[model samples]
Target: MQSKDLLQLAEQFGSPLYVYDAEKIKSQYNRLTKAFSKVEKLRINYAMKALSNVAILELLRDMGSGLDTVSIQEVLLGLHAGYSPEKIFYTPNGVSLEEIEEVNAMGVQINIDNLSILEQFGAKHPNVPVCIRINPHVMAGGNTNISVGHIDSKFGISIHQLPHLVRIVENTKMNIVGIHMHTGSDILDIEVFLYAAEILFDAARNFKNLEFLDFGSGFKVPYKKDDIETDIEELGKKLSKRFNAFCTEYGKELTLIFEPGKFLVSEAGQFLVKVNVIKQTTSTVFAGIDSGFNHLIRPMLYGSQHHIENISNPKGKERFYSVVGYICETDTFANNRRIPEIKEGDILSFRNAGAYCYSMASNYNSRYKPAEVLWLEGQGHLIRAHETFEDLIKNQISLPLPAKV
Candidate 1:
């Protein structure tokens, strides 16, 4: 989005807000679909945990993207966004059997990760079709916290345990309709992805009743100016060719599924915060914004880098300033980063803030979370309202007598 548009949003809805460009989301979705258009059937099941605003969900739905959920609440959110039950897939890890049953009752696709849940769910619902999540154990991701499919990770069923999985399905007469595997997020090596896909394909050979193959998404997006990202075009070309060969060998037309989160909306979002103070210390200068980890915690929690721009003074002289938050802790966004000089009251926009930003925010320090706005076709629509003081007390009960305080 342009600086003027962001400034207008800051003025209209106030600062410390999340603004998403809907056009960018649409374009990203199109890029994937167009690349894999040659496949018989391709589905983009967006990981809703990344950014689960109802408006964004609806936008993705309108763009013909399926829903990938990790919890029952996300399944409900997708349903609320007008997605059909068949279009949703619940892929939970280390969850209870009761939760799996609840999701199964919703009539959406159920992907069982662990072997225990798989055995129990299949025994109870033998006739029901299910999907299996496999851990390729490739260990390919940018960060350890984001990586989930290594040998020690507790994400998917181990490839060596295929015998147990086969036994359970055979004994229960459960229909294994699909196969899945996810290495991790922010995957930079395309060869590693190809290797992971080979493992998924090998596992698919065990299930003759399969109709679809889900390669759980971890496609990377550029975080910095020269940082590397997944080459989707090249990946689509290579993986698609191999996938078609597998389909021919299996003698059935199968659907290809991906649960991409970051690749879809990371670049479409901007988190705007107003500079509250400019502290000049003997050692360093600080550009303190009126926000904290309570609003965007990716940098503090995951060491994620977000490109910050002083939108209010885009052309100002450059300087090194540590951008810090107003929270009562060592909450730093970037330390001694060189950017355009920031002044008091200047508005700064944090790029690549779409995925895992607002969805992971908290109301810590008794601070209210900011509002969310969507920029669709050159217009800004208020998707969420900023929290008020009453929100903190919404769930608290008032006591008649406070024990003689």
Candidate 2:
């Protein structure tokens, strides 16, 4: 999809909208599958936490990809999107044992991330097959906020505690079928990932009934032009060799799985926000957009950079402008950024907006969330409609003025 396509989507759906290129998603999926085509069995579980719209989910489902869910609701979404229970895996973190039991009852694959819940679930359901999420203590990913497999990150079971995990499994005779690790999102270092995979392989040694080893994906995607990206070809060549060697050592060729969120969809999204006003302050020129942090918070929340292009005037003279939002508080998407000259009502498209942008949006400042569109097979389809005032009060309860107290 080009800038013109995004501009057309904005014009049809209005600004402060999310437009996803379905073709990009298919190409990415094909890329990963083709890269690792030599493996005996490779599974790509599309992480639903990144982009959970039903249309996107359905699009992925049609691609023959599995679902990697982090919550019960996401599992339901996957199911609602036409994925079978066997194709969905739940890997929630910091959740209660009761929740785990509830999800397990749904017959989906269970991935336990903590020791307490692992032991609890093992004790309760010894016959059930489960996956353990091991923390490799590998420092990787783009930012601290996203990195999960570090020594200090509270995401997976630390590798040092493997003995306890083994004992718990042995004591309960629980079926340990998989070993998993997620070093975090926005991972650029390929060696660090291989190092983490080694840890996962070591952990799989104790599980005699293992079926797969999930090396959770955080393959970095380029945000701006000339930016570095994860070398998937190199990674596939190295990791596949090691994985095949491990399978040989383990006496069986188990499935290789990955739960990739951003890597699959980050490049497929474009966020379009309308320019509300062009203010000329004393020190800088501010291009205030009609949206705010509520719509896209990565810039302020994680210092993530989104390539902003003034599609309205792509060839116009360039100028440095501070792009601000209309939210009541201070929300700056970009400060002192060089872009083509912007005018009032010009639509600005934020590239690489597919992953966590809309999933993390909010209704803060009493504003509505933007609509979402999916462009599939050269056709535009409205995935979600723009929020309405009635939607804001859909769940609200009206009290009779507290009985005139």
Candidate 3:
């Protein structure tokens, strides 16, 4: 979107709003599908946890994308968004067996990660088709907090425990229809992912009833200017060839699945926060904004870098300013960053806010979450309204205090 367009959105939707470009999302989905067009049976499941707006879910559903959900609530949201049970895959971590059984009863595809749950669930419902999440013990991602396939990560069943996993499967007489592995977010190396796929393939050989192999997505998107991203085209070409050969060896064609979140929508999102104050300290110039980590916490939590642009004054002279937030904490978004001159009330657009931005927002400091807008066909549509004081107290029970008790 153009600077003027973003400025208009802020003016209309109010400051500290999330603006998503629908065309950019569609273009990304199309790019992925076209890259892997050679795959006979391919499934792209949109990871709902990254950005779980019902409207966004509907958009992905209309694109023929399946849902990759991690919780029962997300599964229900997907259903509400018009996704069939068959198209929704529920893969939860460290959750209760009851929750698993509940989702299973809902007819969503169940993917078990730990051995205990696998044994318990398989013993109870051996007739139900299930998927197994395996940890390839490969470290792949931008940070330790995001990586899950490492040896010590508590995400999936370790590859070293294959013999035990096979024993449990055999004892329960359960049907394993899929195998999955997720190395976490911001993965830039296709070779590492392919190597992990080899591990998944080896595991798949253990189950004759396998119908799909989910190579969970962490394909990195560019966060800054000239930043390197995952080579999806090359990876697609190489993996498609290898996958077809594997299908031939297995004597059956299985669906190749990917659950991507950031890659699909990161570039499409822009978080617009209006500048509240420009304070000059002894050593630094702080450009405080109306929002805080409560609105966009990737920087404080994951050390993420979201390119900030002065959309209000794009052509102004460049200067260095540290972007902070209104929260009563060290909620720094950027430090000593060079950008167009920013003044009080100037709107700054933070790029790459599409994924994990709104989904991770919190009501810290009792602040109202900003509104969200979807831009489709050159027009802005209000997908979510800004929170009001009533919303903050909507669920609270306001009982009168006992006299001086």
Candidate 4:
């Protein structure tokens, strides 16, 4: 979207809003699919936890994408967005057996990670088809907090525990239809990912009823100009060839699946917040905004870098300013960053806000969450409205205090 278009959105929908470009999202989805066109059967499941707006879910669903959900609520959201139960893949971590059974009863594909739940669930519903999440023990990704396939990570069943997993599967007489793994986010090395895929393939040999192999996605997208990103085309070419060969060896044409969250929508999103104040300290100039960590916490939580641009004064002289938020705590988006001159009431755009931005927002400090807009075909459509005061107290029970002495 143009800077003028973004400015208009801020004016019409109010500040501290999220604007998503539908064209960008479609381009990304097409890019991934075209890269792997060689694969006979492939499934791209949009990870709903990254950004679970119903409109966004529907948008992806219309693009022939399935839903990769981690919770029952997300599964329900997918259903509400018009996704069939067969297209929804439920892969929860550390959830109760009751929740698993509930989702199973809904007819969505179930992926179990731990051994205990596998045994319990399989023993109860051996007739139900299930998927197994295996930890390849490969350390891939940019940070420890995001990586899950490491040896010590508590995400999936360890590769070393293959014997145990096989034993449980055999004892319960359960059908394993899929094998999956996710190394982490911000993965730049295709070779490391491919090596992990080899480990997953070896584990797949333990199950003869497998219908698909899910190489869980962590394909990194560029955060800033000229930043390095995953080479999906090259990775696709290499993996598709190897996958076809593996299918031949296994004596069946297995489906290749990927569960991608950020790669599909990160570049499509822009978070716009109006500058509220400018304060000059002894050592730094702070450009405080109307929003805070309550809206976008990736920076404070993950040290993420979201390129800030002064859309209000895009051609103005560049200056150094530390972008902070109105949160009561230490909420900093960028420190000593160079951007066009910013002024009070000027709208600033946070790029790469499409994934994990709005989904992670909260009502922290009793602040209202911002609205969300989708830019489709050169027009802005409001997807979520800004919170009102009544929304804050909707579920609260107000009782008169007892008279004090």
Candidate 5:
């Protein structure tokens, strides 16, 4: 998308809005699919938690992508987006056994991460197929906050307890269908990820009924210019060769599955916020935007860096400014970042805003959430409307104001 296009979106949808480039999303989906094209049975499940707009989900679904959902609501969102139960993979961590069973009843894939839940669910419904999530104790991701395969991470069942896991499977006679492992997001080292894949392969050897090996995706996309990211082409070439060999050894060509969220939509999304003020302090220049951490919290929550551009003035002189938001708390986006000179009312485009941006938005400070637009085929369609005052109070039960007492 061009800078002028983004500026036009801001003009049409107003500032503090999310605009997703459909073509970028399509290209990303195709890039990932092509990476593993050698695999006989490959499945790409878009992790809907990244950006769960129904339009985006449908776009992926049209391209034959399944969904990787965490919550029951996400699963429902997939269904609402017209995905079949068979196309949805549910891998909930620290959720209730009842919820697992509920999703199981819906005929979606069930992936349990803990021994207790696995045992309980298996003992109750051994006939249903299940997937086991294993923590390989690998830290390939860039940040601990987003990484889940570390030793102390609370995501998957530790690999050290494989014996106990096998025992539970044996005791309950559960049909194991897949093995899954997610080391976390923004994978820093491809070697570490491949090492984790070996762990998953070894775990898969224990189950003869397995139909697939889901190497949970943490593949990184470039966040900024010249930033390091997961080399998908190289990783795919290496892992695909090893995966085919493993399938041969297993005596069955098992499906290769990945659940990628950020890789599919992160670069495709652009968050547009207008500069509300340019404060010149004694020693620092602050460019305050109309939005805050409530809309994009990755910087505050994960210390993520989203390359910001002054789309309104692409050729302006370079200047150092501290980008901030209007939230009451210290909502610092970037500190002393060098970008093009920004003026009041200048539209700032935050790159890599597709994933984990709107999905993580909140209504803190009772502020209205921004609208969402899908830029498809050179047109910007409003996918979601900006929240109204009624939306804020729609769920709250109002009384007679305590009779003025």
Candidate 6:
């Protein structure tokens, strides 16, 4: 999709809208799959936490993608999107064992990261297969905020506790079907990631009946011009060879799996919001937009930079403007960002918004959530409607109070 297409979407769907390109998503999926085509069995479980829109899920499902869900609701969402229970992998953290059991009852694949729940579930249901998410204690991601494999991160079971993990599995007679690790997002060093893979491989040696090894995805996507991205092709070549060798040593061919969220969808997303005001402060010139961190919090939360373009006037002379949001709080999307001159009411498109942007949005300050459009086959399809007042207060009830204590 082009800047003109995004402008058209903003006109049709209104400002502060989300538009995802179906063709971009397709090419990304195809590219990742082709990179690993040499593997006998490969599985790409689209991480639903990134962008859980039903339309997006359905699109990935149609592409023969499985789902990597962190919550029971997401597992159910996968089912709703035409995925079978077996195709869904539930990898929740810090949740009660009851919730995990509930997901398992639906026949979804179970992935446990903590010892307490692993032992609890194993003892209760020894026959049910489980995957263990291990912390290799290797930081492969770009930012510390997004990196999860460090020693202090609360994401996975520590590699040092393998003996204890094995003991629990042995005593419970649990069926161990898979081993997994996720160092973090935006992987920078392929060698560092590969080092973590070796750790996962070592961890896998403890389980003999493993069905697959999930090297959790943190592949980086370019957010701005000339920004570096993960080389999936090179990583695939090296990792595929290692995986095949491991399979030969283990006497079986195990499925290679990646739970990629951003890699598959980040570039496909574009956020369009109209310039609401041009506030000239003592020190800064603010180009305030109709949306805020409530709509896209990555900038404030993780210092993520989404390439902003003045789509309304792409050829206008460039100028530096601090892009601010409408939220009451200090929701600054960009600080002194240089772009084509932005005028009031001009539509600005934020690139690399497909993943983690819309999924993390909230009704903060009670501003209604915006609509979402799917750009497919050169046509814009409304996937989600802009929220109304009814939607904002749908779950709330007012009570007449003249208190009786």
Query: Model 6 over residues 282-392: C-alpha lDDT tens digits?
Result: 988899999999999999999999999998899999888999998889999999989999889999999999999999999999999989999999999999999999999
Q: Which stretches of candidate 1 lie above 4 Å from their native place?
A: 400-405
| Model with the higher lDDT, candidate 2 or 6 | 6
For candidate 4, give the lDDT of residue 115: 99
Model 1, 1-405: lDDT tens digits are 799999999999998899999988989899998888789889999999999999999999988889999999999999999999999999998889999899889899999998888888888899898999998888988889889989999999999999999999899999999999889999988899999999999999999989899999899999889999999998999999999999999999899999999899999999999999999999999999999999999999889999999999999999999999999999999999988989899999999999999999998999999999999889899999999989988999987986765
Q: What is the lDDT of residue 222 in candidate 2?
A: 98
Question: Alpha-carbon error at 82 in model 2, in Å?
Answer: 0.6
Candidate 2 per-residue C-alpha lDDT over 28-143 given as tens digits, one digit per residue, 9 for 90 to 100: 99999988988989999999899999989988998999999999999889889999999999999999998889988989999998999988889889999899999999999899
Candidate 4 ranges beyond 4 A from true positions: 403-405
Q: Candidate 6: deviation at residue 215, Å?
A: 0.4
Off by over 4 Å in 2: 402-405
Candidate 6, TM-score vs. the true structure?
0.98
Root-mean-square deviation of candidate 5: 1.1
- Screening candidate 3 with a backbone cut-off below 3 angstroms (N, C-alpha, C), the clashing residue pairs are none
Cα lDDT, model 5, residue 100: 91
**Measured by C-alpha RMSD in angstroms, how accurate is candidate 4?**
0.9
TM-score of candidate 1 on Cα atoms, chains taken together: 0.98
Per-residue lDDT for 68-172 in model 3, tens only? 999999999999999999999999999999999999999999999999999999999999999999999999999999999999999999999999999999999
Error of 6 at 140 (Å): 2.2
Model 5: CA > 4 A from native: 401-405
Which regions in candidate 6 have their CA more than 4 angstroms from the true location?
Answer: 403-405
Q: Give the TM-score of candidate 5.
A: 0.98
Worst 10 residues of 4 by lDDT: 140-149
Candidate 4 colliding pairs:
none
